[model samples]
Target: MSTGIPNVSPNLNLETKDLKTAPGVSLNENQSTVLRSILDLFAGKPSLPKLALWRDDATFTDPITVAQGRDRYAAQWYGLQQAFSEIERLHHEVTDAGNPILMDLKTRYVIKGINKEQTINSVVAVHLDSEGKVQKVEDKWDGKLPEGSIQNVSSLLDFARPMWWINYYIAWAFWIWSFAWETKKKMTADITAQAFRHLNAVTVPKLVSVPKNEEEDAKKGN
Candidate 1:
């Protein structure tokens, strides 16, 4: 039965011959094989054999992740298969003159259960060691890497949330207690003043003076 969906892996070739490379520089046989594997990975075809091209300690960096070890790096490529139903390699230009081989990739991605397709352009840089094993890879989408310390500041602020919350609770408790104390003090003073005025108006008490000896004794006791 034709499902009306196209198969993804038809031709993943690196020997395109017309690719723009550095002047007087051509990719070797091993590099071509590795580049083909990379294309396969980008086409959402992740295999154990293709992942074997990377060293054990190889690192990979992309916009969302900075992964260490070949196995860790391969996980992202594997996840790509689960995300998109099909991936079509639209265009690629390779440069192999330097330590870091670069690929400018344009791809069409078809997400599962979605009617629309997305076109994405990316730059992949792979650094190969003497044994032709990948040492590091950096993938930048739309050829842009995130720059600035704002992200670092954001992480710090997130970590400091607990501390901020504790301080806020302490200050709030003090503010409420202080208001309670103030209200109590004002109520007591006002009530005492009103009671004294009402009692004085009701009764005319005899004026009595304390003896000088008793007053001196009270002052000495105080």
Candidate 2:
């Protein structure tokens, strides 16, 4: 899924046949298929095939926006295509985490109009529902200009140079924000689980029936 950030690299279209699965990762048949489809989608394949893997109420989240619904997720691609001149995947590492598959990617690309090139290291976590359709996706990344690139600060005069400082600040802010949000989200989930555990641990007293004529029964027995 696209991050909805302007001037960012267009998403790649990776082929299943081209990917080499990481060592010691075991994936079920369904998960393997989904993983392949996800790679293809990122490589810039037609949206229809990618969308088919997602549920109608699927959500895509990144630093910029939390897009809910398949339609919104699909729209981000259009913006990305218009913003970047070309996108290339440099390296990738895939991890199979059962229901939620994780992919770490390094990518490089050139922005349109300005011809500025950038590299990004990003991780995408995709969650699949019980039916094997994508339910949610979380994307996180850090971007930088490659060393010795024309866009490097030393290449341009101070006044004409790109305001890289601003970009640095923004990236840092996003990192902190994402960290805090994830922390809070995990904490909340933990608290909820603890609450349920406490509730389940509570002991209930069993009821005992009282005999109305205990004395009479004892006398009759005697």
Candidate 3:
């Protein structure tokens, strides 16, 4: 019988990582095998044989990317190796014990060619089809909604870096990100408010009228 999913490329990395669970957590026999296999992909060690574990149309989505099919999901994971030099699994824990397993992972990342590091927490929700094949994997970074339309492969690297409001970057990243965003937002709002105020300023005539010599003045100003 053919699995709907394509056979994983033999060239794909089958390396595995040690699954480090959070304190006070004990996994059942099934959860141990399943979670270990899945978490290894994010630990900078992807498993090629595990591709058969997912269904053909299985989706993997985080905040910035939406991918359909097991192949695309594999792309997101495999891209991790290219995007990052090091991924150290700090700890991970299963938050939900239901059909769609919710596992929260905290890991430290070092971008390739840069020694600067960032610690990120991602919550991976694994949904299983009726036959126990993977149906969908929703990565909610700190429990945020899977909301975004960027389908670029490059944006897949964002998964390895800092993103969204689960804040606390390597100090500088957080400071700059916060300051820049607030400044830009305030500046835009100020500009808009000033524009409206200028339009209704009392220094002008109370009545709104069609421009008379504006065209001639515009040409002269230019």
Candidate 4:
């Protein structure tokens, strides 16, 4: 059952601001649970500020310092909490129905004050692990504004924010995404076909050891 992957403890000193540390990023049960709690807390309310680690240097270390445990976790949690401040709901759907490579389309509602809403769309490529956990998560976004959407919602906001092509980045992003996708599809199809041809040559034959008698078969069954 072992994957033969060495258990190299991750550097705990990563800036904690620019990334999300999903719980169970490591295989260790205790570490995984604690990481999950931190992720859950930030995802749930995001307002809770102080984060703490229950272990000391004997339990956790990256090389340089010893006092960087709970504080590091707290910093990362805060960053994640801030990153999603503008979003309300994130929706995802699969594109390739038969494949695990999901076409995640996300529609985020931009928060307008306390209750108002604006729409921003995004796409992502997601890959899951054998355990049904997210093995990889890649975010895609267009910095451009939606076509005509900005014009439609123009009256809602103050006149200070001018119409820049920067608003058009979202639309441009979608265009770029389509192009990239088509190229990937062609390249992947070609690579897969080539790989399939090697399957027969590279596969090892199975060696089945048959039971010698009914008693042995019964023992094996047991």
lDDT of every predicted structure (CA atoms): 0.55, 0.50, 0.53, 0.29
Model 2 spans > 4 angstroms off: 1-14, 142-222
Better of 2 and 4 by lDDT: 2
Model 3 C-alpha lDDT per residue in residues 49-136, reported as the tens digit of each score:
5555677798776543455665456655655564467889887878675778888888887665545566767888888776666788
Ranked by lDDT, the better of candidates 3 and 4 is 3
Lowest-sum lDDT 10-residue window in model 1: 201-210
Ranking by lDDT: 1, 3, 2, 4
Candidate No. with top lDDT = 1
Alpha carbon lDDT at 140, candidate 2: 66
Segments in model 1 whose C-alpha atoms lie over 4 Å from true places: 1-24, 148-222
What is the TM-score of candidate 3?
A: 0.55
TM-score to native of every candidate shown: 0.55, 0.54, 0.55, 0.25
lDDT (tens digit, per residue) of candidate 2 on 1-222: 331222322232325554455788776655665666666555544344445667779976554344566555654433344345777778777766565788777777566665666666777788988677789877665421111211222233245335634444443333233333432334244444333222211100001111124353234221
lDDT of 2: 0.50
Residue-level lDDT of model 1, residues 1-222, one tens digit each, is 111113322223332334455566688666766777777777776555456677779877654445566545665565565456778888888855477988888888765544346676789898988777779888776785444322222244357657744564443333223223332334244444333222221111111111134344234221
Q: Which scores higher on lDDT, 2 or 3?
A: 3
lDDT of 4 by residue, 1-222 (tens): 121222322322212122232333223332333333333332322222112223211111111111123333233223323223454435433343222342334344322223334343444343334443333323344321111111222233224235423354443332223323332334244333333222211111111122344454345331
Ranking by TM-score: 3, 1, 2, 4
CA shift at 37, candidate 4, in angstroms? 13
